[model samples]
Target: MTVNSANARIFGSDADAIYLAPIGTPLPTGIDSVLDPAFEDVGWLHSDGITEAFTGSKTEIRGHQGARVVRTRIETPGTTIGFHALESKAQTKGLRYDEKEVTVANGVRRTRRGAGQKVSARSVVVDVFDADDITVKERHVIERFEIVPDGDRVFTNSDIAGFPFLGEIIGDYITFESSGLATDTVWNVSVTGTPTGGTYALSVNDFSTAPLVYNAAASAVAAALNALAGVTGLSGITATGTSPTVITFPSAVTLAANGSALTGGTDPDAVASTTP
Candidate 1:
């Protein structure tokens, strides 16, 4: 969620609905902005998984050829969100990209398939203290800062654990820029246990594809797993992850399956079923 000091509190404890506004459009006082809002009088945002998305042009040309004019037009997209969380959180003192520290034989930081995108992962210093770490929560001004995305690190000179630093400021609101671009529907499936070493077939959205052949090696499994991105019917589906790779499909897809001659590996599960 991109932060805006709008002083709005959406999804209150008793709220059965939400409000949405266009990008760059300011919402009313105490109202929050959702990803895609209705341009007509307020439309309903569903809590269920069903929706109707326009697949064609929403606006047409007007007047005759000599005096024709077309202003703004809305085109149908491939996917839509029935429900989404418009807000997110970042702990003042947690790891970047949420990587957990573990003690391996040589202090090497290895993560499971659930570790999140490696591009955003970084090691950090424990410079700040938490409430449990100290008796006082800083009775003074307990400074707050707006976090800059893709900027410098935070808490640089303070002897904190995670550093180099994304600089810090003194404020309560952290405003992040937002783009109206759409995101993909993704799911991560971990192939665990010993590989029986054989061919595995995959099925997506009821369309079956060729079998994926691999050995017991982890690298081999990861390679073959990612190759599913090119399947004919898989359209916008993309396969990612290592050890436990994720396959991101178009939001319209509802099912994906892996049937391999290999043994001991678990069936692919939705990314929601696993933590990242």
Candidate 2:
């Protein structure tokens, strides 16, 4: 968690929930500028597993989105009497995004339209925790981590020591990348454990041949996955059978920037990922 001098009192407390607990007689409401506040509103929304994230965040979650939990320790070990007492501690994760829309409302009959986006995230910082011995409670922060869809990684680890714990949370990090070849268009990615050595097959039925498609032959793409296997930089490309099981080849595939949604239910879980 990022820290600074502006919020030191609550620095060591594990950030839990974020709600504007207004401190005034006006019933503090959400302030737009420097004042004002309304009833408690959602300060953050995380998707550690299940969530329809149209924006961004960083989290290593599983099971149902927003159903997973991650705990962080803000209070340092060992405490003393009459020590520095925390007033309040809070954590926040910023979420940001953009979209197209109309700038102003009312005014002209035909107003020009514009583009825009919104960004927001949740924060998990320590709160006004007692400096003395109270109780060691594991503060869990719920967030989400996206695999960037295509070319997602596959690794080995423990239940809590899984790769997602170390991968998600970055708004820009790419979890998977082909050792060599990169495709500009895709849906999802899968890394099988079968290691095809060099042969592969495809579901020509999964793609649309309308207006003629690119490399219409599943055999051709499979051949490419095979041919590139032995070629420089293409060693990660592997060919498979009717249904790709385990294929290894060159590690050169562009995942996120080009991939769309997986077609025909291509399960990414079945693919066994590995290092380049």
Q: Which regions of candidate 2 are displaced past 4 Å?
A: 1-119, 122-221, 224-247, 250-276
Compared with the true structure, model 2 gives a TM-score of: 0.17
Error of 2 at 177 (Å): 12
- Residue 2 displacement (Å), model 2: 33
Error of 1 at 221 (Å): 9.4
Best-performing candidate as measured by lDDT: 1
Model 2 lDDT at residue 92 = 13
Model 1 misplacement above 4 A: 1-181, 215-236, 264-276
Q: How do the residues 152-220 of candidate 2 rate in per-residue lDDT, one tens digit apiece?
A: 123346322111111123232112111112332222224333332322223221221122111124344
lDDT of 1 at 173: 21
Which lDDT tens digits does candidate 1 get at residues 51-166?
22333466766777676775657675332112222122122222234446533467554543334422322211111112222211111111222222222333457532222213
Candidate 1 residue-wise lDDT at 78: 35
C-alpha lDDT of all candidate models, in order: 0.33, 0.26
